[model samples]
Target: MTSQEEIKVVLLACGSFNPITNMHLRMFELARDHLEDSGKYRVVKGIISPVGDRYEKEGLIDASHRLKMARLAIQNSDWITVDEWECQQPEWVETAQVVRHHYEELISSENNNDDVDTVRVTPQLKLLCGADVLESFGVPNLWKPEDIEEIVGRYGVACITRCGGNPEKVINQSDVLYKHSKNIHVIREWVTNEVSATHMRRSLRRRQSVRYLLPDAVVNYIEENDLYSEESEQKNADVILAPQRYTCTN
Candidate 1:
């Protein structure tokens, strides 16, 4: 594999991004640096696909807000872009399908290009996630085995190591993960960050400052919209912000 030319890869991160944090954006750089520094692959793109509103997860804001925040968060970025396809869907879409959709979109665009002389190597699309998401695959009935196989075995995954999370151990325990272990790139974070959307919401609910944890634009947007407050919760009383099964610190 080392003898072959550098492979072009796009990292796709699908999440609830109820409110994207700095750590969420940091994952892309960390994964890109690791993949590029290895001299094996050139990461051409980074995508953040916020889950649809139908995904009734705790502390989740409206899909419009998440999508807007995502776009604002990556406004300064050169390669990373927010894809609203997932968030626009009428129902919740799984992560595996999200990866496949982007993979096909990239391929379709390349095929339609008029430049015939340009080399058309199919870029590999891999799901980018944190260790907390990786660990959830082990929970009983949480994920289907076939979906896991399709995501890990087919598209591949670039997992960033989170604090107190052992990605390697989780990979070894799961048969599906172990089978495609080579595809799973576990990136280590030298300077750990514990910022997460859940913790950020808690702070916001209390009317505390979230200046540094999120982008300035995002901070201002939250303040302007009055999101994640007790009144907002009361307004949408039907939507319960239940305790999340996974302690996502990403």
Candidate 2:
């Protein structure tokens, strides 16, 4: 097993993170625990990949707010850290390119110092996703097959199964994914909890309690900002379903 400083695993848990929730935390914990159990790394690190530029995507709050919520939600968890690099970059970056760049940066940083005793580390990178995103892979536009192979060849990949879905379906479809990458892993524990950001936003608009669905800090922040209130929901209904619009184009 690699030492803690030398061991690096990037959890590409990127999303709107409109409000971070316990389910998100559970995903991180499970990934960390699984990697440790495999005896590959001393510590697992988490990186939040929040979308930055607002082109066609809808319902995206500013990156700063999302970054803050991510930081606050993971404040107590030592393994988790927010990665704002993607957000800071110029607009309309492809997902595969982002993944490649991130790994390159990681490698460059490890070799930055010349001290022989410094102990350089080559960390494994994994892109974390729910079953929904995996299912979307069948279509070419979301992520192309060649690009998928490139990502796996460059860095490790991991996924957590969504409730009431077979994760193996996507895995089996991508023969290239398994062929190129030796370190691909899927979470054995299925998350039975059904949590969705869309549902949470709608509930908030209806004045429903989101206590268990979101972290305490996130819930408080939402209430303080009056985000997703009835008026806000009405104004942003079109934006909320922007991804769905893309599906029609495909």
lDDT per residue as tens, model 2, 123-169:
77777766666566666655666666666666766777755667666
Q: Pick the candidate with the highest lDDT.
A: 1
Candidate 1 lDDT, 102-219, residue by residue in tens = 9899999899989999888889999999887799889876676777888899989999996677888999999999999999999998797889887898899998999999999999
For this target, which candidate reaches the highest TM-score against the unseen true structure?
1
lDDT of 1 at 6: 90
- Regions of model 1 farther than 4 Å from truth: 1-4, 233-250
Q: Model 2 compared with the native: what TM-score?
A: 0.84
Give candidate 2 misplaced runs (Cα > 4 Å): 1-8, 234-250
Error of 1 at 230 (Å): 2.0
Clashes of each: 0, 0
Error of 2 at 14 (Å): 1.7
lDDT of 2 at 148: 68
